[model samples]
Target: MTELLDQVDWQGKLYSNGWRDASGGVLDSTEPATGAVLGQVGQADAADVAAATARAAEAQPSWAEQTGPARAALIRRAAAILSDNRAEFERWLVREGGAVPGKAAFEVELVLGELWEAAALPTQPWGHLLPTSEPGRESIARRVPLGVVGVISPWNFPQILSVRAIAPALALGNAVVLKPDAQTAISGGALVARLFEAAGLPDGLLHVLPGDAEPGAALAADPSVAMIAFTGSTAVGREVGAVAGRTLKRVSLELGGNNALIVLDDADLEVASSAGAWGAFLHQGQVCMTAGRHIVLESIADEYLERLAKRAANLPVGDPHTEQVALGPLINERQLANVDRIVTETVAAGAEIRAGGNYERLFYQPTVLAGVTTTMPAFREEIFGPVAPVVVVRDEAEAVRVANDTEYGLVAAIQTGSVDRGLDLARGLRTGIVHVNDQTLNNDAYAPFGGTGASGNGSRFGSQSSWDEFTQWQWVTSRKEAHGFPF
Candidate 1:
């Protein structure tokens, strides 16, 4: 067991009846890299969902009753604890999620920063002082937590993705019923309970019910939950959104992406090549916002593609635990197969493999496919793997068109020597986040981050923006005397 998990207060209290289903069936949590039984993780069914929601609904009012300042204080304390134990948390992230150690540390550190930023929401919720009709009549708008928030996070960045959204929800004085991605249920659930206790969060304020779609859908469909926040595929996001919609509850979705990277004619060859490689291959390209499609202007398309192909081929691939590893394995065999299918299909469709398309023990070599057209399935879909498909474009206008051709608008990046040109191209891209001279996955704690179109419905881990997602604004007004109302 890792040091972080060993410190857990799991005296059969925080997690009980380990790895059992709602019907009391045991399921093993499989390690993605090796397909070994990591441990048993509890699986919640509809009944478990109901129970968790009931608990959350019951605790909601008292939690909401706490002043925002009080909640903020608790969040600040949590931030402190995260900073104090960053190493342990990062290690746990690597062991459980198969993230490269450096990337894991970066995400954990970002989570702590997010905690502190969310803590400041109490004193700085950007509500409005509405204009009043008459003098001596005062009107103001105040934001309040959406009681009983349902947070469903993905496994990609388990600790950061799960906690970042939950922190803001709790800091804004809401009770949370979280269902992390089943693959990372144990780590995510354990961290949530432990961090809350370490940070002094009120008992029963946060609950983790790890399970499958049955439980999650039930939770979202429940009328008791005021809001639902989810991070996953667009297909599932639509299903969850429909359920939440029917109940008239607030919903925030961070879905999948087939993000694009545009390398303009004026772009520095070296910089663009490096950025493109990282954007496409980082996280083994498992990130929703990974730049799967590389759009290079025709002027230097050949040279750019050649340089990127070399860089992709050279990235060190090995076990995540090894310090020499620059790229780790895909999350599971399913992901490996998914990438494999795309690679094989692209090749069959006449696209040439420029660098790599081989796999060994879950580790996939960084691949770059040349002469890929928009009609190819790899170009049309979210290839969440270490595969970069290069498409040549005539000019900036064509680059823009090709980048926006996809159904996914989660994130997009443009590289150009001219800042003005980059900004101009960026403004035209439909992605939720557009970057100039950098990749869209460049994370900042305070920025409103998420996606658009099929990519996502709203933001997360974005300081006050996340608070807004988890909170509701109420209009509070006082008058000198009761005014006569005409009904």
Candidate 2:
């Protein structure tokens, strides 16, 4: 892993008209596992941002005028390039993002799939013809690309999260100014720029500015930017949304979630427990859609907790490079401390530590906490760690009630023997996604992916809807026959 990191010049720099050096001071990008400094990432200041945005504005019109199929062809090239570099990307994710092999694999696959999906976007229908009132008049509604889209992507699943917006935005003819999170700046954002460049993308179309929140805030508030697509915590999303709102810039936010993974009384304890452990602990429960709150029916709660505890206790927590390690460390010490704090407070609030909740350095144990209540911090807040708080409910009705009792409406799942009952319960659960006899961690590139309330705001990914976030639908009409109005 160290050899691979050394082989690649990990020095993060601004990518505008091709890769260029940033003028601002440099930040040290360190490995979370060992706290070893990997390399220095050049920071971008306001001047750099202005130059990139100006270039993006200049480049967007020509890109937008190109035929849809022509644009699609370029996206196809990028997808192929991403697929070819899968091994390198996986290693980068492991080192910089702390992704386990399994997590890294999924991230690569998802990125590739979404790129392919974006490749097909330009050829899709932009809008529709509308019925006209007058004869010889044609009315059409067509979606046109926004001029420049400012994409503020989070560190988690950097490749997928960043590409999720970038691919579709570029395919639809909108130029992008990307601001990647500081933690995964080089591993995530810089690699994305490399893929586009290698695939023959025009310079200045996709700019990656690597830094902290200062740059992010500037991007959000830039007057020249046409739209904003952000994926991160709800708190930051709100601030971004506020900045966008002040200017009425087109914005799409995929924010936080506290999803519920419920086990019905009739669920197979064996299958459900395994599914529960994976849903709650995979990637160290760092996913926004992770099932942080496990709502179990009273009849099966004890057995489910017992099985889940055993599995959690055995889950390997160490360096991702090692084969023995199933789970990797948190992205950095800050995240590790936050996760530790939430778990500690939850335990203090009367939650029982049934299994694992220990941590050494950045590594956190896959934890299962029983006797957790709704009022507890672990149950109330988004743990964003490998901690699962099991909440036992009396019946399905109470389970549904407890599931819907959160500010988030991201996702929910019910594991049960009866398909009909599962379907019925799924409908009643208020969430953007509800699964039957499955876990809440499922995601497919072709499906619409988003949430309601705090989870997101009208930016549904996957399928054709991904284009909707980056384009505007305008009603246009033309009169073929010239008509003169007489007094």
Candidate 3:
């Protein structure tokens, strides 16, 4: 076992009924920054998924029978356990997920917030009484768990995304079967199992099966699994949604984004540039809400571009574990190549590179591209790298038009001196999330988080949304005596 796994007894193994070896075998977990083998993780296949889901189904009824306060107490213990091991988990995030120190710290904080928020879920109201028309009759509508919830999380922001679903589902009395991305299995899956296990959660209530697509597909298609919460690319989300749809299982899809940051003529270029840089370059732009498009007014385009380009050029990119840098390497060479292809093709299509347009291994520089149009790939597609493409719009209408042209409706931001103008423009933008006089990167554990159109299927996660996502409704009616019916 590696030192990172010392906090928990289980190391690089699947947790179904208990920590055990996987039939599919183990794979090396490598660090993207150095290609070093961090550890070996057990991989789960279709059969493994079957066993886990069966166990979860069998365990869920008893968990749901527990009192609400009892479930809340267990969830609170998990939060405390996470708080105790905060620093250690942050280090694992840096090594396993390629997160910079600051990003790792922020992710840990977000996960903590999620745990805290989820801890309160079980004690909340789960049902309401309904008015009855018949004399001496009573009616009630109650919220109930959806049996086993299968969570399929991506490599980027694995811990935060996975727990946002896992914590709440379990707290709401549903057993969970989590299948984290293979590259981030330990941090996303095993670590979560350990926390809940140490918190005294019963065995079979939670199962962590880290594997590739085969297990994920099986998890979604399994009849025993009533719901699935998936966070990943739009392409994969569609497939998951389709499979879940076939079984008529409830699914929440939080997919990709090509968000925009709009700068108005009356905006402060300094503040706007800082927000834009942070929105586009945070976590090396691997976020689903990354501001890929920068739509600025033509009057202030030159000055805004200068400020953005300067910020981009000065951002340090390297192994975040060894250096204080603004950005880290892309997840792997495949992502790096995709980023390179987008930048190279955009530049070839008449877009001018303002600052950076290159990479060394997986370390891609924070790039700024000017002279970009909506027809170009950089403006139209979601470039999941630290590249900011600026598009000059003649007016506010044109900016809104350009921003809303894409298939994604995830998030958008408007920067302006007047709050009224920013708010008004935000109304015109067609996205699930909008920020006025700010940037596109934002999340709150107590607020509803999701997207529309290609970004998702209009499902949300967090806060009261969790109740709707993880549970179903049931209505019960009763009478004091048997009523006579017409013969």
Give lDDT tens digits, candidate 1, residues 1-487.
2454566544223232222234424446666666767666566677777776777778778887877788789998988877777777776567667788888888888888888888887767457899989777889998877889888988888877887778888877788888877777766776666777767776667777776787788889988899888888899999999989998998888899998889988889999999999899888898887988999988898999899999988888887765578788788888889899999999999899889989897889999999999999789989889999999988888888999998888888988999998998888899888888997578787888888889877555488577568887799889888777588
Candidate 3 versus truth, CA RMSD in Å, comes to 1.4
Candidate 3 residue lDDT tens string, 1-487: 2333575556557888888889899868889999999887789999999999999999999999999999989988988888888887888789888899999889989999998999899998889999989889889999999999999999999899999999999999999999999998877877878888889999999999999999999999999999999999999999999999899999899999999999999999999999999999999999999999999999999999999999999999999889888898899988998999999999999999999998999999999999999999999889999999999999999999999999999999989999999999988988999999888988899988889999998888877899999999999999878978899
Residue 55 displacement (Å), model 1:
1.6
Best by TM-score: 3
**Clashing pairs in model 3, backbone N/Cα/C closer than 3 A:** none
Candidate 2 backbone collisions, by pair: none
Task: Report residue 357 deviation for candidate 1 (angstroms).
Answer: 0.5
In candidate 3 the C-alpha lDDT for residue 86 amounts to 84
Each model's lDDT: 0.81, 0.87, 0.92
Q: Candidate 1 at 234: error in angstroms?
A: 0.8
Best by lDDT: 3
1 versus 2: better TM-score goes to: 2
Candidate 1 ranges beyond 4 A from true positions: 1-4, 8-26, 125-127, 134-137, 458-461, 483-487
By summed lDDT, the worst window of 10 consecutive residues in model 1 runs over 11-20
Error of 2 at 84 (Å): 1.2
Question: What residue pairs are clashing in model 1?
Answer: 19-41
